[model samples]
Target: MAEVLLVVGVVVAMFVAYNIGGSTTGPAFGPAVGAKAISKPVAAGLMGLFFFVGAWTIGRNVVTKLGTELVVDPGVFTLESSIAVLFFIGIALLVGNIFGVPASTSMTAVGAIAGLGLAGNVLDLAVMGEIVIWWVVSPIVGFWVSLIIGRYFYARFNRMVAMERSTGPLLDVDRSGPIPIPRVHETTNRRELVGTITVVAIGCLMAFSSGTSNIANAVAPLVGSGELAMDPAIILGGIAVTIGAFTIARRTLDTMGSDITELPLTAAIVVASVSSALVVFLSMLGIPASFVIIATMSIVGLGWGRATRPVTVPEAVRKEKAPPVTIDALAADEPGEELPPIGEEDPDKIPQASDLFNPATTARVVLMQNVVPAIATLGAYLTFRFVPIFGI
Candidate 1:
């Protein structure tokens, strides 16, 4: 029976990792694919590679916390309770994807596990409190750093990173070699190549950061329960993530590549860099960072900071604080999903993407994401408290 339960736990862990792979590709590589700097297949491959690298190295920090440190006693993570915790996380992932709401995977995983710990009398207040503190601090750091960049250096950065792909082949084929090799040549404009490379590089950074924080969400419970060792669990989870990258990531590469509030290239780069860096930092500290919240806040900060750059503090207090006629503001009055750009079509169309990042909407979106985690917490608590499988 224990052996059967171990197999079931591992299967659930893979399911969680698969969902994570599909969900994360959009955020990690969307900008590169959106800019046409790389194809979807290439993006998927890079995401998998960097994710594995991150998991093998820095991701262990976060796994340690989820698997051992979050609870007062690791013995509390029995196979039955671990499976129950994973079920809640898997449910959160499924609901979030089906409904087009991007919940924080790490947060959901933490919530479910913490719920298990709480019900089993093993919850660690210090560790949980520390995780909560970092969750708040990291997003705030992301916001302020992005805000400073937007207000001060954004224009210059935008001008510098202005990269358009050339009409010709980006790489020159060398037939002289025994095997033909495609390499950059004199035909490649240095500036355009640099810009293209930067976008793709940032995408890689995002993938790596995601691996750092997210790998633990998939395999930590199994490892905690002693059903699987850390090394094998990480390896299995990596394989599942790779499968997701190659298979289910295509649709997201299209829809979220440009949608999810229509980000410009520079804005995407800045937001990705800031948020990814923050996640990696927190992962190193064994915290399950909330990438979605941090990235959303970064995006909102960039837009708000840039928009309010020309105004003074008093002007901002008097004018900028007023509710702008944004899509969120008019979402009720408007009818359907076919709203046009703010200026290009009818006056009642949705506000420009620039105007959609008001503080209220930003807060609401972040708070909305928490719903999945909250549900997972509640479900986990109830199941462990009453379920016979927990052996309580």
Candidate 2:
């Protein structure tokens, strides 16, 4: 029975680790991917490799806490209880995936453990409270930090662009045709060296931080249970997460990168840095956190901060001024505009891509990503508590 339970625990841990990679790699690399700095496959591969490295190295501390420290009495975590916790977490992750929500494996695992503690009548209120507090605070802090950093970076980037424009074409190019290429004489060795160093530095930091912060999620459970040695668990968890990064992380990355905000490369870097800091801090506190929530909220907050003006539409449409009344205009108009000819269209149009990053849309997408996961967490908690016949 002990051996069977250990196998179950390991399997569950692997699933949790995979889901962690799927949900988190986006936040780690989405911005880079969005900015075209890295291809999706390469981003996923690098993210996976770094996640494994981090898990194998500094992730042991978090694993230890998850396996043993959160609950009051270590003796209460029998093999059966561990399996039950793993089962609940796995189910929650499955549900989140089905709904296209980027749920945190860390949050689900924490909730499952807490639920198990309650079921076993060994709930540790103090530790539970601490975890809850961190859950609430970390995302908020991450959001604000990202907002400030994103704003600063954007400001600097715009200023740089303006300076370049004023300095007379940084790239000397003949723009006579559809395709334009820079003149060879325009290229400078000094500028090329600086650009190369900057790109390399950003890539290294992004990969390193991603790996370090995410390791906690993959190995925490195994380390906490004392069933597997910490080092081995980290290795296994790292491999699992890396595999997941390569396979399932791309979808979530696209959702975060393109759907959340139209982020410039610098803004994306700011978001990544803020998110990594928040996750690492929480891991140090032994508090399980949702990287999905952190990254999404940060991006959303950045969009909101930058959206200085509210969207408004004209209150009334003058019939004559509405341009040749017709069924098409009547159908397209939201309440006020009467009609216009189908063929008569406004040649000067507001681009749809510009509206993609509008504050309302950003808020909606962020909320959708977060709310579904929260609901899954609640469902997992309730199912674990009341579904007595299943013995979870």
Instruction: List the candidate 2 regions with Cα displacement exceeding 4 Å.
Output: 31-36, 39-41, 150-153, 158-214, 250-261, 307-392
Residues 1-392, candidate 2: write the lDDT tens digits: 77987887888778877877777677666655654546788877777676666555555556666667776766656666566666666676676667656556676666666666665566678877888788788778887765554333434433232111122332367688899965533433434333323433454455555555555554555566667777777777777777788888878778766853444544455566677777666666656667667876776555533331111112112222322211121112222233232223341221223431345654664565455446544654575568774354
Instruction: TM-score for candidate 2, please give it.
Output: 0.68
lDDT of 1 at 124: 95
- Can you write out model 1's per-residue Cα lDDT over 131-152, one digit (the tens) per residue? 9999888888888898778656
lDDT of 2: 0.58
* Whole-structure CA lDDT of model 1: 0.80
Instruction: Candidate 2: give the clashing pairs.
Output: 63-220, 67-224, 67-225, 68-224, 326-340
Q: What TM-score would every model get versus the actual structure?
A: 0.88, 0.68
lDDT, candidate 1, at 357: 60
Error of 1 at 376 (Å): 0.9
After TM-score superposition, what is the CA distance of residue 220 in candidate 2 from its true location, in Å?
3.1
